[model samples]
Target: MPSPAPWLYWALLSALFAALTAIFAKVGVKGVDSDLATLIRTVVVLLPLSAFVWLAGKWSNPTALSSKALIFLGLSGLATGASWICYFRALKLGEASKVAPVDKLSLVLIAFFAVVFLGERPAGREWLGIALISVGVIVMATKR
Candidate 1:
């Protein structure tokens, strides 16, 4: 059997990470406040990421980044932090199976933002996937 492409492998790994994140977050947040839970999770992530950053020598590459790129990267980090906080809070309050699908609604948000700000248009299949995701989220959000 042939090896998967690098991007394909990374994508698959990312999906697995996302699945584990929800399960672990749910377990970690059990009987704990979401704010504190997120803080603990941040520490958990930071320790390993800091080690990887040091190992990768990115800590010494400050001169390689343009000022604008650095600013945008910082902003992106802030945005991601905010999103993670909200995601953990939602996971703590809701079922992981439901919250995971709802959180995935971000794909639709990303698609809309891409069209508006990036001038990128989605192909027909992409639109269909977005629509199905939207419908699924709506269905999941509805309580019996």
Candidate 2:
């Protein structure tokens, strides 16, 4: 088969890392306050990410971007922080299998939000995939 797009490769890698994050965070949060654990994780991420930004020389480029890009990036950072805080809390209290699926409900929300806020029109197949993801999350998150 022909190779998939480059973005698909990155997306698959992202999913793999995210799965590992749930497992690792679940173990890391044991006997620790979830918010504090999230803070520690943030520091862990920052240390390496900072080094990467410096090594890649992308740090100064942020200033070259428009103020609108900076503002949106700042907002995205805040949202990511909030998501991590809640995710750690959920992992602390619930099984990773359960929490992970519910956490992924964000994908369905993202599809809808993109259409509404970003004016991105998904194709019919994409909408079907989104609907299937919504249903899978609901099924997985529901208690037996």
Candidate 3:
């Protein structure tokens, strides 16, 4: 059998870590202020990421990036911070299974955004997959 693509490997790792994040966050937020929990988590992530960039000699000259790139990256970071705050708050109040599935609804939005903003046209089968994901999320999110 042929090896999977590099992107597939990375994506699988992402999924694994995301699952862990939901589980861990669900537990960590218990009896804690959700915003404070998010702050602590952000610190944990920042410390390791900073160490990795510095120790691995992967640091880049921020000035070299174009203004547009910088602006977009800044906006993306803000969006991420907002998302983390909301996610932690939700996990504090809801079951991880249901919360995680609702969060995955972003996948459907990503597919639409990629086509509309990135001009990337997915094949018909890909659209079918997106539709299924949409339906699955609805099913998973609904109460019995």
Candidate 4:
């Protein structure tokens, strides 16, 4: 049998970790404020990521990056921080099952944004899948 694609493996692992994040955040935010919870989670993420960068010899001087790269990366960092804060707040106020599916609505938005912003066209089948995901998110998010 042929080996599976590398992106598939990493994507699966990321999905698994994301699910765990939702569950853990839901539980962890029980009594703590969501903003504080997000801060703690950011520190926890930084420790391992910092070690990974160091151990893998991936560290580089940020000063060498171009202005566009710096600006986009900085914006991405801000968006990520905002996303985590909102996610933590949602988890604190809602059931994980509900919150997680609603969060995955980003998948649909990602496809749309990729098409518009990146000038990439997804095949019909891919659009079908994205549309289905949008419907699924609506189903999961709404009251019966």
lDDT of each: 0.91, 0.95, 0.95, 0.94
Which stretches of candidate 1 lie above 4 Å from their native place?
A: 1-5
- Candidate 4: lDDT over CA atoms? 0.94
Superposed model 2: Cα runs more than 4 Å off: none
Candidate whose TM-score is highest: 3
Per-residue lDDT, model 4, residue 43, is 100
Clashes of each: 0, 0, 0, 0
Q: Give the Cα-based TM-score of candidate 4 against the true structure.
A: 0.96
Residue-wise C-alpha lDDT for candidate 1, range 1-144, written one tens digit per residue: 998788998898999999999999989889999988888888999999999999988786776889999998999989989989999899888999888988989989999999999999999999999999999999988756
Greater-lDDT candidate between 1 and 4: 4
- Tens digits of lDDT, candidate 3, 11-123: 99999999999999999999999999999999999999999999999999999999999999999999899999999999999999999999999999999999999999999
How many pairs in model 1 have backbone atoms within 3 A of each other, for residues 3 or more apart or on separate chains, i.e. clashes? 0
Ordered list by lDDT, greatest first = 3, 2, 4, 1
Which stretch of 10 consecutive residues in model 4 shows the poorest summed lDDT?
Answer: 135-144
Give lDDT: candidate 2, residue 138. Answer: 87
Give per-residue CA lDDT, model 4, range 1-144, as digits (tens).
999999999999999999889988888999999999999999999999999999999999999999999999999999999999999999999888888999999999899899999998999999999999999988998855
Candidate 4 clash pair list: none
